[model samples]
Target: MPALLRIGRTLRRTLLQAIPTVLGIVILNFFLLQLAPGDAADVMAGEAGSATAESMAALRSRFGLDNPVLVQLGHYLNNLAHFSLGFSPRYGMPVADLIAQRLPGTLTLMAFALTIAILLGVILGSLMASFAGRIPDRLLSIFSLLFYSIPSFWIGLMLIVFFSVKLGWLPSGGAGTIGSRLTGLPAILDKARYMVLPATSLALFYVAIYARLTRASMLEVKNQDFVRTAYAKGLTPFGVTARHILRNALIPITTMAGMHIGGMLGGAVVVETVYSWPGLGRLAFEAVMGRDFTVLLGILLLSSLLVIIANAAVDIIHAWLDPRIGAR
Candidate 1:
């Protein structure tokens, strides 16, 4: 029943769930990539008569394409064990390095957007729940519904026009200017300046979702016996609500937020493409167009890893916050 021991078991269970997910991603991507319409080797080699015949054979042998499907998959898995996702034969670079370089942009944007969304969602949701069925709550219900209905790509374009073009307050697309590196503060400012509009656009949809979730959670927790008891014990309305109601409602929000982290990355694909941010989303989109198999596989594997980790985090947070589940 000890908290530490309970946490250990919870973590073990979470990790165990990851094994099949990882294997599934590897297998699915492998088969699907094979099913696609062209020979990866030929695609990388370019036109049949364009490159020297001898050199094409060498490239194929170098990447292990000389082997059969099963042999190739085994080689792929072996390389993956050493953390070599694959080398992009087409791009002539390591896939892992490529993904690592672009990961920061996606992480920075997503982290900022999630922070803004959670802070705004919890606050607005709390207010909505507090004034449930009243005029303010009704207005919020309408607002969230309307905001949620807008497409992400459309919103990104609107933000670009209104803020970047019309007002000229933010950059139209690029993450930073050419010489941002020459000045540290300017680079940081430029980085954030470009991120603001895109991050805001991404945050809006999430806030709409989280607000509704928080509002429902707060309403449920508000009716619990602990809240009633605190109210009966001469506690002020705010005090009773803050200590008992907020703490209980937090468990649901924590779980929801953790689960949604992967969804944010998926959404980033559309958002990053819209703004032309140099991130995994844009990279994967480009890879598919170019028929860059190694890059596509790397992206799929990284995405699977991220989603699995997010799910594990949700379970761990759930156990930590509510010891009742940890006990079992």
Candidate 2:
């Protein structure tokens, strides 16, 4: 009960700290976007091939782009306080609605990629540590380095060529087939099939990172006195490694994984672009090209919130894994 209380307190404290952090990100993203060369009005006018000075002025007025920066910021914050994300001139929809349509795709991709990275990485790292300096270790190290060095977009493109064009085993792009109207298990399976390439491409780089990190951490932990004692107590090598070495080494892995969530979000931009995945990353890309700052700002704010939430979840997991963390 006391442990639960400690975890609860930790969660509350983390959330409390996050409020200001999210606000700061919101303000910073707003100002940073203001520095960009054009606004939605400029893009709209360009798309129309030409516009008179009066038309441009009216467009700016409509978007509130004619307002001073400080006044615009104040208006944005006010709308945020009312739970509004403003409207996307490019998409012709509310920012919140646009994000709602895309958020699930991004979340699903991130979840699959993270799961693949962690599971494959931990297993490979454990094997490499066990074999330390053997042929297996060297081979795995070389492969990990290769994966780490490759750009995700290139990996994505290669997957498309091999799997989609040559083997014809899976989809080359998209989240799912259009107008299929699939339901239940079939729908889920269809989505998973489409998800495979992009998820794997996004995951490969992180898998390399976690694999190397886990191998190094486990090697260090294996030399600790407690690990030696566990071995002395006649525990099987697997048992000792799993219970003592890997468990202790997981602290660093967990920390890195938490930090990597934001990076993964950034990488999704490239992966989504390559695969034509209908996620926020692609939406953000479109917004940038269209100079739709409102939509872009909304995406940034939501992304910041997601990172904060992920970190909080990591903290809770840490507290559970090491009770001392909660006590602290």
Segments in model 1 whose C-alpha atoms lie over 4 Å from true places:
1-5, 41-62, 182-186
lDDT of 1 by residue, 260-301 (tens): 888888899899988888888888887887677878988889
The residue pairs found clashing in candidate 2 are none
Q: How far is candidate 2 from the true structure (C-alpha RMSD, Å)?
A: 1.0
Clashes of 1: 0
Model 1 lDDT at residue 71: 90
TM-score for each of the candidates = 0.91, 0.98
Residue-level lDDT of model 2, residues 1-328, one tens digit each, is 8778878998999989998998999999988998899899999999998898899999889889999999999999999999999988778899999999999999999999999999999999999999999999999999999999999999999999999999999999998999999999999999999999999999999999999999999999989999889999999999999888988989889999999998888999999999999998998888999999999999999989888988998898888788788876
Top candidate (TM-score)? 2
